[model samples]
Target chain A: MPEKRQMHLGQQLTRAGRWSRAGITSGPAALWLGIFLALPLAAILAISFLTRGEYGGVELPFTFDSYKRLAGFGELGFDSLYPVVLGRSLALGMATAVLCLAAALPLAFFIARLSEKYKGAALTLVVIPFWTNLLIRTYAWQILFSPNRWLTVAAHSLGIGTAGEALYPGTLAVLTGMVCDFLPFMVLPLYASVEKMDWTLAEAAADLGADRWRVFRHALLPQIWPGLGAGFILVFLPATGQFVIPDLLGGAKTAMLGNVIQQQFASSRDWPFGSAIAAVALLLVLVGLAIFQRKGSKHEVLP
Target chain B: MKINTPLLNRHFCAVVFSAFLFAGAAQAEKSTLNLFIWSEYIDPQIVSAFEKQFDCKVNIDLYEDVDSMLAKIQGGGAGLYDVVVPSDNLVPVMMKQNLLAPLRHENIPNLKNLGEKFVSPAYDSKNRFTVAYQWGTVGLLARKTAGQPLPDSWACIFDPAKSAGSFMLIDSVRDQVGAALKYQGHSVNSIIPSELKAARDLCIAAKSRSVGFDGSVGVKNKILAKTAQVGIVYSGEGVRAMVDDTNTTYIIPKEGSVIWVDNLAVLAKAPHRDLAEKFLNFILDARIGAQLSAYTQFATPNQAARAFIKPLDLENHAIYPLPEVTDRLEFLNDLGFKLRLYDEVWTQIKTR
Candidate 1:
């Protein structure tokens, strides 16, 4: 009877240990995401299907009208407004991420190649912009691009813009502000990978009669694939949904997806529609991540 | 065996810290009155004075536009704020939604100070649910260069042929869209899809040619900086801008535009209803009303307060437009369900 009782006690302990191991590691994160992330996402998805309330809140009678409206179907007819906006945002996000990648690659390499003593200082310089308020920095850009400022004056002299006019409230300025804001996100991740890269592999490729392009494609790229993908996402998603930089730097001529989402929630009071826009954006991001995980993150040689 | 003790400790700390924060928030101040209104609409001195008189803390929250204000109230913020200042057209809608609590006549004795005309506005007749706070028209704020004629109509912003360079659409949906609607000779609250479509097209075309949309103050800044020649702005901001720099002027526009009365009312589920009424009553006082008007540069509805108001403000044509201009001005009507038309059009204009 003592042996049987001991065996039963051991069995109970074994079962508890299995759960405790998993429960301890993932329990907090699962619970945290379940309540904060997953639940809100579920609620947004639910609300997206519900009808818009008369008072500009959500109500009953579920419909896909929001998604339909998003797909360029409006009461006035099939206008390209939403689709155009989504396309514009996609372009902005893609452009910003590509620009960041172009800017960050060399800078990341430069920082990683810096003597040990200068590495921290260079990294700090990259991150100093983060310390300042984004709004303030954007305003500073506005001032710098003002007619009185040297940059705009120089641009005017160089025949880029009219004399006595600000260089901002335009697309170029928006892109500049976006690049400035997101460059750090791109650089830090890239620098981490670039620093750990085995330079010998690149040298070996070159030594074997491979050109510089081949060396980078075969040796360097495979090493930094994770960082490049991470940085692209880190920049792209936020850039796509970003309203502030576009609002401040770009002329408020056209609303980005973020601005549209804000309008729906605020002035439009169409919470259900807003939720649909948001849910779509979220779904797009998830789809993008999945695609990137499958294809973009894989080590590939340029064929 | 490896242990995750530090990770465990970090998570434990986070839990305790969050719990502490919750406990601290639960012990909020008593006798606190939350006032929700347009930014810079209220005078800080009056707020402080009221706070001292009632031995209570007044928390002020600001909204830039009517829709945002309504959105907040309807989005479970009904029980959060004690008082909210909403525009005239919104009163009927708020009433239908049960967003407002009828004023307790006994609690707000200072309602007597309101002008006869203001006492019973069409939007909130009999002053049942709201008290008139201020009345003003939305108009063009233009920087009149020495050589150029000032922008004198909604056409200045909305019409391509009559375009003033680099104009910004004001952030308020009703006011700016109302301007466009007026320019097209439609009612400011026109629910007709075709008319709204016309207005929407005009706005989008103008937007591409002009500077983007901004708040009234931002528009004023654009005019002042000469980055923009004209912008849509509220009467108060327009008036203030005119004073700050003599080169600028505010006008009611040739086609006429929205004339709105912003009213103060307690939320139906106001957490501090009693205090909200007190705040309303205090606002209605002759001296306080005049002070509020002088600071905001908007027209005061307090009849008794007029004697205390600055004659300079009273005489300003922008504050009180001419009779002929008043003849054409329209008050925005609550379209109820038809508001969706404008909403869709606005979204189109914005996104496009």
Candidate 2:
């Protein structure tokens, strides 16, 4: 009886140890998320409802005018600028994700196929762009895309643009910058999945009279969906709200959601309006992620 | 091998404890005054010299525009800063908001050193809250290329048919919109709905053909690099660019443009008010004032400092606009709550 009682106490100790261990491991992460993420989110939401002071900055006397303004119900009347800008931002984000995926897939596959000796070097090359500041890289693109530069000269020779004219402050330049900035994000995750791919399954599918496309679709894509989904989210979310890339490369011909929000916080000095726009943008992005996540999980199968 | 978690924890705790002690020691504070002003507006040497003279450390912060500075000050930065440099248009706004502290003339004896024009100016009469730092105009900086003659009229940029090659609009809301309003013979501070809308539409149209909006310095750089032909920029930058690159010329469009006086003022909640007052008086010293203007290439409003200023910089019409130019140029005034009209119109111009 004494032995049995001791064993029961030991099991209870182990139970308590499990709980404490989990707590110890997750405590910092929980604390960090609470402070940086949850606190700011709550503040922004609160600020969104407050009135903008005359000089700029939020004040008391809670108002929904910011939200109303964002919804195109301004003193000037309804205009499609805010809605159109938001739509354009979403479309641009999707385009960036698609472009990143298209570029990363072949690159990742090529790197995965390389022998062990060169694989690390090829992977490092993908990450080299990340070492430099994004702003500097974008500015470099401006120089590269500027007229008389060899790249622009070459592009002109290829009938891409007129001679002696800079190729930038245009959409093509913006897209190039966005893709260059986000390529590593897509490559690493997709490469992780590609490296661990089961090639034998593809061979077996092909041997069972499946075409090359069918074999890839049936065997390989499923194996890589998890990484692809993660990479897509990683690329798309940041691309959606990117201001600097468009500001530098796109020439500010039209404002994106990020630019509009930035103007409010910076020059406009209307923090309430900025917060309202941000809260709505956050909601839109979350909804987008939720939909994408649902679709991705449906396609995901355990390897 | 298994890791020793307890030992690692002990080491981390010890390091963190020491860090807290170091932080506490540092937080005991010093004779430091925080100066918030525009980027590239002040000479670093002037700041260092002030620090040496005062025997106090000066920590500097920079903002690109006045609105951002005002926003920061109002948004809890008031308690963090001692001195701020705001433009003429913002003085009344800051005063009304109670962001500025009353200037103690007794503390700054050099107030008498102000030029006739700067003394008891319209923005803050009797020198109650502000002192003039530097003054300049907003104008066009154009690259004189083979085909692109420099634009003399706002119409050259706004009137698409006579476009002076690819250009960039000034990114500042009031400045850009003001330029557009002036193009249509309207006030830079026009509150008329129709005039404002017309200006907004004009900017929106030009934005596409132009290389988008950029700061004055960026405009100067763009022209210097020959990526663009003309861009709206401030007189100081335009003048500086002219000095460096002869091919670049700064113009005040035939239609009048903005002339501004950037002033030095103390924040209401300044932690080191005495030190700030000292710094203000130090800047007013004739030699130091001249040095500041010469280094920055901005016009000095200090009468006593003019004799010490570099003759080239002092006489340049771009720095101190000619009387004719001054007759045409208007000072941007604080619009109070009505400034929201400009804000809304600016949003439309930027977005549309």
By DockQ, the best candidate is 1
Alpha-carbon shift of residue B175 in model 1 (angstroms) = 2.1
lDDT of 2 by residue, B1-352 (tens): 1478888898999999999998887765447989998999888999889888777798999898887788788777889999999999889888988999999999999998999999999989999999999999999988887865667999878998888888888888889999999999988988888898899899988987787778888888988988788899999999899999998888899899999999999999999999999999999989989999887888999999999987887778888888988988989876755676776787787677
Interface RMS for model 2: 2.0
Task: Classify candidate 2 by CAPRI docking class.
Answer: acceptable
Residue-level lDDT tens digits of model 1 in B1-352: 1478888888999999999988777645447899989898988999999989998899998887777888888878999898998888888878988889988999999999999979888888889999999999889898877777877778777678877667788866787788888998888988788888888888888778787788888989988988888888889989999889998899888888888899999999998888899999999999999999999999999999999988888888899887898898898887755776777787777776
* Tens-place lDDT digits, model 1, residues A1-303: 434533343455667766886799899999999999999989999999998867666778989988998887877788777778888898999999999999999999999999999999999999999999999999999989888799998888888877887898888899999999999999999999999988988888999999999988888998898889889999999999998999888867667889888888876778888898899888887897898899974686443
Give the poorly placed runs of model 2, Cα more than 4 Å off.
Answer: A1-25, B1-30, B145-150
Off by over 4 Å in 1: A1-17, A300-303, B1-30, B163-166
Q: TM-score for every candidate vs. truth?
A: 0.91, 0.91
